[model samples]
Target chain A: MSTDSDAVTAAVLVIGDEILSGRTKDKNIGTIADYLTAIGIDLREVRIVPDVAEAIVEAVNQLRARHTYLFTTGGIGPTHDDITADCVAEAFGVGIDVDPRARAMLLERHKPEDLNAARLRMARIPDGAALIPNPISKAPGFHIGNVFVMAGVPAIMQAMLDQIGPGLARGAAMLSETIEARGLPEGTYAGRLGEIAGRHPGVSVGSYPSMTQTGFQNRIVVRSKDAAALGAARAEIEALVAELSA
Target chain B: MSTDSDAVTAAVLVIGDEILSGRTKDKNIGTIADYLTAIGIDLREVRIVPDVAEAIVEAVNQLRARHTYLFTTGGIGPTHDDITADCVAEAFGVGIDVDPRARAMLLERHKPEDLNAARLRMARIPDGAALIPNPISKAPGFHIGNVFVMAGVPAIMQAMLDQIGPGLARGAAMLSETIEARGLPEGTYAGRLGEIAGRHPGVSVGSYPSMTQTGFQNRIVVRSKDAAALGAARAEIEALVAELSA
Candidate 1:
């Protein structure tokens, strides 16, 4: 029995050395997070793994085992380093081959003459895996068990997510209420804030210290599924902020 | 026997449920990556685990064992959820207590009377660990073996990194040269780029596709420890991009 009302859960495994090297700013994670949150499927975890086969296999097995759905971005290219599909297949103990369905998708873009060995690498799919259509590129993403393997490119990954997001089971929307502190150090507010947070067990209150041109500002965020409880906590927080400022 | 000159390496383990729940946007990873890169340390891998004792212990042990330095952000706070110091102590098989050094640091800001049970939580450190000075809240970070436990808050974590960055072992700076392609699809340049990358065995080239207001652009980045090799590879890449555009 599911304890959570909005129980659809997912984890993202971002596979690439480019990101680890910091040469690439990861836009995919933020994009996926926003998309999943909007669709009501809670994104539980995100892991950035290198191009290593062993790492990919281990992360795939672990995340897939834990979450209801797993979305993997990157390492599905035609290059030699693109080994995500093969590793994912190996993780599930399945044989990988150039699937006709995947080939058909790619065939639309390239002439049969132009489809070389490297290009054909994109068409490889694990057994019993279903294809998730990529609108931008003809090469489709494949799903085996709970894991959906998509391209590393942000645009294409987003496109694939847009296609798949609608089909997944989603949980209740996690609500948030934010109270902006004008000019206060987080330390000054920490004590009373902790007391309020402790008193309200259902709501989670987080103090974010941000630097402004004026000075330091703390943004207190109250999050809960219950709106009434959230409102009550927010009022207390706002009152405390006022009291502290005075 | 380090292969490359100026080779700096770090592995980051982010401990928090806030990140997993997508409640908090992780600012520490990018900040640490940028800081470490600037200091000549290549951040090789990053892991985000929840505040679970088993997970924290396992990640800390594994990362510290493999990497030159392991920087952990999060799970060091006043809340009940904050358990990184204890877990880290357990991982190292060391006894933990409210260490004098850490308490001294915190006592500077907090009055002896103001130091409650919750506040005292920040002073706990494993035996044999060195204090990592925190410039923000004065709650000191600790270093156990090669693992540096830091705060989850971006600014505080950044402050700790600033204090610690200069002291760490640094590798040769990972230099990068960017070659921008206007309106070039990554697929169009993918093959030749791969060829160029293969030719320059020491250099790593990544193709980043970005969408502009006008259209799409692909930014090719060539990174290498050897500046001369990077320049040579970059020239070849520029020539290829010019040829492709023509």
Candidate 2:
């Protein structure tokens, strides 16, 4: 992995019909987003597409071209709908077949006689890709170019993510501080918050308003890659909250 | 709001930096997905983009052009980051300003004196749009063309969806049945499942594998608009499972 220090940005492409059909609520997007942020990689965008090969191929190509890295989860199992690997290969204009390395990983869990044609489907990897080992399940994920493909199951995806995490180049980690507005609603402090955000170009300020059982709860979040800028913005937001509360 | 019987589809655009930063776990995408499915509007795709004007505008244009309807959540608030409405207007190349109807709705919740500039921002609506009433906070969402814009907060978004749902022209509602594989792993039944899926072009079959306390739990879900096709696929899947188990 090249040690580039630029702002590392990533996009997540969740491939599944289950998620779009609401059969499965996606836990992977949040997990991946949190993981990328913690690793100093900014998660810029996310797209959820159905199991259609055309949709999958188009999304992979579009996202991979724009972001520093594109991570995909789901549609990699041993069923008819599991067509992500082929779609990714098509997206990159590469040939795909059962890789010996991936087949070896499957051997750790399945006996040679038990590895049927369907089971061997799990061993298909795009040409020139590196395997991302799955500790929970023997079926490995793979990364080609700047895209990482992993399992849809949260547990297996987590394991694969851990394996892929170390090799990624680090960027300046974004620092953030949240200041709760307590009882003060966003309408009470939004004007001033906007002004504060405008003044701090180095930092991004966001006021989130959510409804609690009692009433509206609001929070002001300040984020910046620069530590001093983050601190300054957080201080201003805290003071704004204090003034609004008083 | 034509009562057309053709299959209706939608795409959701979630706009917020909080979600991208992982500061907030997104609840809107799943909620919208389930709602759309229940009403016979197939949720085709979902995109989560940050609070950037260019990104929001581009996504809005792309999604609205492709799907039968486009639903957007978040960024329609009273802060600097709340730029969704403006971005949407820019996407459609329409003029936008505070609408009288939206302002009237806001008046139900906010007093004239309390309707500050930031609060007034909630009343901004694009040209030639119909208002979606918000009962909770009374800051109405709106629809211009095929795109419906709603709040980021779950409660407010749900209310707006309820208002929008009754007017939508629904297609045939998809019917689904899930068959449990008991202790049978996907690898055991994947081959037959693939054959069954291939035989039934009218229905979609998906095999999902999850780990439980006992071990792996797998389920085969068959969905189709035609009940006859759904039943045919389900029966074949059931027979395959029994044969494998015996």
Candidate 3:
């Protein structure tokens, strides 16, 4: 049964051949993930697709349809490979052109004489979309329906996310407590942890194992939207971990 | 039209609620991406989903069906939320049980008495699957069909990747040249870059703009399996950038 009516969820679609080709390591996904979680928006899924129009379009359509908000980064630059805007327009079945509003935003950064055709490509926004202002580059990102098209550059994307952050509908904030089971291997307490998790359906328990110089430094993270359930599970888990350690 | 008959592509399925929840920043995706690119296997698509079984199974099925190979990281540890093994089995419609091979591998690190039920979970492999050895920790990751399941831990995952790297079918290695146009803005050189890309059908050109402390530090990357095309495009891009710099 659903506990909250205001369970806003989001998905991120990272569109770039640079990322897939490993020329660029993506920082936006994690940045957005952390931001959304802080704002009580559940980031359900993330998909990274190449600059190819078909891939971008398919991913955008699917993600936007499924989640309350779909944030996309990359491919809005003024290059041949930067086709995210066009792909998004095609996905939404809308006409796209140079919006005067976006051009005005660009005017702040570029002189009127310097606005070449390639520069003008950044002004192209789908029909009926609201512009998400870029404070850094003045090349505006846009929000059409549930989808937000942002710049690939981390700074610009962060700026756009900050602009849109205030307006998003939020869900119940997920509260989590992490217990370090550094010397305690997951196998030692996993069965009991599972049993505890089953008993408290509202809580989610995860065991993460990281390698240290000595051996495995494991951690158990308990999360729930309900503070009472979260606290109870945390207490039980902490006790279990303590018993195992002793 | 396909240029290389040996074009082996891969999709990465990162299974973790910790990643989506932003408690963990994913280092594995980028590591795998860089490795795949170096090995000539085009990292096509990547999807990061939560620990939910249905989501994991659906993503595994979809990614494995589409790409030449699907490499999954996370959810294979001995914990309550570690269900990637079962999900992969369900996705492939196969029976799963503790494989003797995997247990034997685990026996190298874990004592016979220490190999409890929770520890035995690591040994669970789908029928007809081959065990991918984990050199760091003896818990083995399995490769059933085209999907190679590995641990979420960076060190362990890297070891598993190293173990399996030599056997993967590789495509023609993509050669790339990066031309730094740090001072020149993207808008100034984007048109010429687009033109160069259009003329060279075999090459893939990308303009990446990153913000420096002073301003935008941009780079143009030209990539192709054909060395001649890659060279030509790189030369043209360099000329264009040089001319613009003047």
Please tell me which predicted candidate would have the highest DockQ against the true structure: 3
Residue A53 lDDT, candidate 3, scale 0-100: 81
Instruction: Please say which candidate is ahead in DockQ: 2 or 3.
Output: 3
Candidate 2 deviant stretches above 4 angstroms:
A1-5, B1-5
Supply DockQ values for each candidate.
0.32, 0.59, 0.71
Model 1, residue B228: what's the lDDT? 94
RMSD of each: 3.9, 3.0, 1.5
Tens-place lDDT digits, model 2, residues A22-100: 9899999999988988888988899999998889999999999988999999989999889999999999999999999
Q: Over the stretch B129-218, how does candidate 3's per-residue lDDT look in tens digits? A: 999988888899989889999999998899999988999998888888899999799999888888988899999888888898999999
Report the lDDT of model 3 for residue B17.
91
lDDT of each: 0.80, 0.90, 0.90
Query: What global local distance difference test value does model 3 have?
Result: 0.90
The CAPRI class of candidate 1 is: acceptable
Off by over 4 Å in 3: A1-6, B1-6
Q: Supply candidate 3's per-residue lDDT for A52.
A: 83
The predicted structure with the larger lDDT, 1 or 2, is 2
What is model 1's interface RMSD? 4.1
